[model samples]
Target: MSEKNREGKRTARERMAAEREKHKAAEKRRRALIVGASVVCVLALAAVIGVIAANAGKDDSSDSEGPAVAPSGAQGEDSLVIPVGKAGAASTLVVWEDFRCPACKSFEDTYRSTIHELTDAGRLRVEYRLATIIDGNLGGTGSRSAANAAACAQDAGKFVDYHDVLYQNQPAETDDAFSENAKLFELAAKVEGLDTPAFRSCVEDGTHNSWVAKSNDAFRSGGFTGTPTVLLDGKNIYQDQSMTPEKLKQQVQEAAKG
Candidate 1:
């Protein structure tokens, strides 16, 4: 072959090699993309499974036996001052709550809407057990004041209303604005049929001291290390941010079936 022809053949071979390299690089990029996508999908699936497992653990932990109860008083009493559900229902759930607990507030909201339906149907009853874990956190005044005010409102036959208002007006967990005794009184006055003077006097004179102490003692005996511990038919129902009205309703329905 002539020299030029030979050179042309060599050039053609080089071009073919360059094209192969390009294809190889493209294949490598495609493989990387596929691997990255697979990793993301696996990660997403793992996250979903983790959330489900965490929720299941929470449900199991909450279903453990609740705190111990004393022989008498608020914890052991058959009746509660703050009526939670309807007047007469076979299955009653008693909630021991701290006014300053955000989780308690969430539980209260869920119960208020859903329990109202159950109560209206006469399928469920609810009772509030005022727990005061916030006392020490709130400079030893907020929790006691809120509990006392609730008791005082009970004396005035407006415990439920007062309880609702307290939860609505609850301050941030990091802040202790609910510590003001005066604010407690203010909330009491807002309850219809509540005589402001009588309620204030009761709060000031510690007329509800026994009730407050009893509630706190019950909370302690119940092995509640935190606020918003719930008791469903004497069984503890653990609550957290993930607790929803649907889950509670399902639990209640299951218990009713038994």
Candidate 2:
């Protein structure tokens, strides 16, 4: 009850109060840190999911069994090579292409007529192999869909006509236009006897989707890197840019002489 005793007790009480406030502030800071870290982790996980969703279509060609169907006269499991001429022609030309590829459009534009001329003369046989690498690299289903439709056209015995029309109306590589089945049917109307209900069903049903996959598998199996890959008798003519359209004709002619 003395004055000194009272003052000592009051000072002790003040010290304890100050210590409790410090502990409370430290707890609040720890809780805030934990909350902030949880928010960051949640945001990071959402970003990863978004990336995966964006790339889902890019892996469509990963099926190792190839497509559920293949075009007629498919060579092994790698391609359904639609032939353009007599089976026993003197020269065999194999061409690999992606329908959405600009380079392929250019190649076809330049040499399409010459190829037809030779094929008609029974001097050369050409085989077309489809590829969808553009779809994998560019993140869309246009290439695969277009190739499938092309194979479907083959089923109707109008592969040559439909193939020509596709390149003739090919959209820019970045447009991803061929993903639309309506567009394919619209283009099919340009080819004779190709716009029937059966053709519509085939294209819309994606009846040749498996064929597209098989063709893509064949493309990979061949170990080539890009589209418009032209080979004469299994020899890569464009390996070093040594072959132009004229050069291709000459090579085929020379091969015929022997």
**Clash pairs detected, candidate 2:** 67-210, 67-214, 68-210, 78-218
- To one decimal, what is the Cα RMSD in angstroms of model 2 from the true structure? 3.7
List the candidates' TM-scores in order: 0.61, 0.81
Clash-forming residue pairs, model 1: 62-238, 67-222, 68-222
lDDT of 1 by residue, 84-136 (tens): 45555668877778788898888777677777777667678777777667664
Model 2 ranges off by over 4 Å: 1-18, 21-67, 239-242
Worst 10 residues of 1 by lDDT: 57-66
lDDT, candidate 2, 1-258, per-residue tens = 999999999999999999999999999999999999999999999999999997664465443344477665555434477777888999988899999999999989988998998899888998888889888778688888888888888888898999999999999888889999989989999998989998888878777787677678677777797998988898877574766777777877888899
Regions more than 4 Å wrong, model 1: 1-83, 86-88, 239-243, 250-258
